[model samples]
Target: MALFLNTPKLNYWIPKLIEESEEELILIVPYIQTSKNVLNALNKADSNGVEITLVYRENKLSDYEKSKLLALKNINLLHHPNVHCKCYYNGDLLIVGSMNLYEYSEKNNREMGILMNRIRFKGQETFASRMVNDRTDVFDDAILEIREIINAASLEKASKKAKQTAFKIDIIKTEEDIVRDRCDRLNISFLNKKFRTVEYLDNKWFAQCENFFDKVDVVFQTHRIEITFRLEQNELYNLYRAWMQTYDLYEFHGFKYYWNKPDQELLVYKHDNFDWSTDNADCNKDKKYYEGLSTIIKKYRKITNK
Candidate 1:
């Protein structure tokens, strides 16, 4: 059975939901302008070694909120553009509501929620509520829906310190990348267009291309690192668009651009200087590689309306 709750009760129980967690705390709430009490509860939960997963609206977090949230330990922050429901669950106890987890929503808005315990329900049977009757109304079904939402959300890395401590490991590869190499000669451009532009680098919009000009901004923080990663995809298109005015300068994404002297070349994509002798087998391999690469480049041009 689920206990109905109003605004005051919602505030009281949300913190309680977080505080009572012995292992994991999952909060799927959008627009997280957390009140002081709620923020303190989250901080304390982190101190106690509770694994917390918080999902909020994408690009909605201000730098202040980010600084505060990123400072915590044992917490995973995620972003979902579509998340609007408010749910707080600690494995067994669940709160489903018309809440935003925003400070004003709890203090001023007349919000409502239903508190449920999985322990109260026996087996796979769903307890019935007035005005609703179905398999979906069960407590287990609600849990499943929450899990689906979390699965669809993208993991957002918010820590500046983590980004500053750069990893020397570059490139995104699967067993597929390794297998393809076993069957063909490889180049930086091969993985460059094949992985970074065509598919998501890591199923996230942002991905650093494996080698080729990737290590240039090993020190520059801000958006420079992210922009340089994107330049791999941009530079590939620039090769045909004459966006380059000089070897050192280029335009990106329809904007006029220039290279910062401080942001000097960390890495630049250069084609193979291999001199090919026109033997029959060598000619065949060269043509095959060119055709394959040209196809990918053409497809990217179509997708980007270049």
Candidate 2:
């Protein structure tokens, strides 16, 4: 059987579906803004001991929205980075169409939805089991990684450029060296210059030595690290582009690039767009060049221990 409903008309069937659902409710929506109807439906489902899983895009959630969603015990608000489909699956029943959860989509915009009560399955297993098996945790570690990138981007946007170069550099001769000889050199230089202590993070030793190691500034990838200092806006961009050229790094598509003037920090990242072509020699050359360039920066920036 087929059923049709408009936005204002959703209230009629929505509550009925929630009341009848016994196993699970899977909601797939592209965008979710704050709305009373959506929240109320979710709350009702939660109170009924239904396992609610919402898959939506990973846009920044407002403080209010975060707080409201956090209060719900059973609601699972997940990030679906590639989610573009809109549908509702309640056990064996599947509703597919263009209708969104928003009031406008429901009440004003032209919308349509299909309600399928009995689905035919190709295998011996039931249709509900198949649908559940297709379910994925679209909001786990990937979301956390994306959040870290977003946080770093925010910091990059707010920092001011240094009036003078304040970055410390380090260099090592061999690729297998455990200790950062470059940082050791930087420590001596920093002591002589009396620059404030900056934390350093190192990968080779898997160690974070503070004050003892001249309080190394943040430790980073064994191959790449970032140091922030003040520079003119144009100078900063020039330096960044020069740095990129030092490695001949080609720009990745869809990556968001940002620079903070006050902090003199530049960040270029779009984890999703990164494509390291293992098959393409040119890409490898480009990658090697960039790695070499980072090595060069570390070599010169370090205050030589000798």
Candidate with best TM-score? 1
- Most accurate candidate by lDDT: 1
lDDT of each: 0.55, 0.44
Pairs with backbone N, CA or C atoms under 3 Å apart (clashes), candidate 1:
171-210, 213-267, 216-266
RMSD in angstroms between candidate 2 and the native structure over all alpha carbons? 20.7
Worst 10 residues of 2 by lDDT: 167-176
Per-residue error at 185 for model 1, in Å?
A: 46
User: What TM-score, over all chains together, does every model reach?
Assistant: 0.46, 0.36
Task: Please state every model's RMSD to the true fold in angstroms.
Answer: 21.1, 20.7
> What is the C-alpha lDDT profile of model 1 across 1-306, one tens digit per residue?
567999998889888878766667778888888789889999888888776778888888778887788778767788999988888887556788998768899789999999876432122332222223222235446666766776798877623322453311111123233334422433333443332322233322222334323322111111222223235555545543442333332212111223333233322221234332342363354344444334433433554455
* Per-residue lDDT of model 2, residues 115-204, tens digit only: 544332222454233333221122222233333333332121111111122211011012113234434433443333222222242212
Worst lDDT 10-window in candidate 1: 215-224
Candidate 1 matches the true fold with a TM-score of 0.46
